[model samples]
Target: GESVGLHLPTLSVQEGDNSIINCAYSNSASDYFIWYKQESGKGPQFIIDIRSNMDKRQGQRVTVLLNKTVKHLSLQIAATQPGDSAVYFCAEITSNTGKLIFGQGTTLQVKP
Candidate 1:
């Protein structure tokens, strides 16, 4: 199936730094994109989203870049913080299903 999965178990970084989380998708027909942030024991919160027609989208503290050419995507966080320390997921949506196909998750570790 063309769902998301995680490549590594964890990623460790220091506070006040920038973090880049990567996601590898499975389906090439996906059109819309979204990024989510999940705490230790909670559901994912919407972070940012982009469409296949666009290459990039930005939020207050986060940015999402999509590379349809390779079926890959990435998320960039401006400053690493304890609050920013969580699991991240990338989702793809198309005209069909109206459901999102997620990518392999990446865990952001903030070392204070």
Candidate 2:
């Protein structure tokens, strides 16, 4: 069998600085992508999303970039704060199933 996916499990950043989280998806047929933030003891919250038809999308202080060519996606946060410390996950919805498949999450630790 061959490996189909991968992720970074942790990321650290200083408070008031910026953070960028990356994800690589294997399913090229996926047409939608999303970034989620989850705090301790809480469920994941949606941060931003981008469709395969688009390359980038922005929301509030967050930005999501998608590169279909390499099946790469990234989330960018500006002026990250303590409240921004959480586990971030990237999910993709495949055209075949229309169900979201989540990648291994990356924990964002904002050092105060």
Candidate 3:
């Protein structure tokens, strides 16, 4: 089964810092991965993505690293700011349907 439970509603951080958020999935057969950021009341925005065959991928200020050996995934934000405060989600694309299975998410708070 997938992770189904409550999580910390938010996280607070000072401006101009680094942030790291984490998530785990249940299916080992998942083939694609994506990271998204959702602001206060808006829908999710695509940040970065990594394929199952890749180990790491990078973008402007974000980086997504996947370790299939342990089925672990991580996102690193180079510099966190108030503008960066939002709920971050990691999703794995399942085979067959190709639907994205989203993680619980981590809310990052950037205090200015």
Q: Top model by lDDT, which number?
A: 2
Query: Each candidate's lDDT (Cα)?
Result: 0.84, 0.87, 0.80
Looking at model 3, the pairs that clash are: none
Q: Kindly report which residue pairs in candidate 1 clash with one another.
A: 4-102, 4-103, 4-104, 5-103, 5-104
lDDT of candidate 3 at residue 20, scale 0 to 100: 74
Q: What are the per-residue Cα lDDT tens digits for candidate 2 across 1-112?
A: 1112435789899999999999998878889988889999999998899999999998999999998999899999999999999999898888878788888789999999
**Candidate 2 clash pair list:** none
Write the residue-wise lDDT of candidate 3 on 37-77 in tens digits. Answer: 99989999999999988989999989998878777888889
Our tally of clashes for model 1 stands at 5
Report how far residue 82 has shifted in candidate 1, in Å: 1.2
| Ranking, TM-score, top scorer first | 2, 1, 3
Lowest lDDT 10-mer window, candidate 2? 1-10
- Tens digits of per-residue lDDT, candidate 1, 21-68, equal 887777778888899999989999999999989889889989898888
Top-TM-score structure, candidate number = 2
**Could you tell me the lDDT of residue 81 within candidate 3?**
71
How many clashes show up per model?
Answer: 5, 0, 0
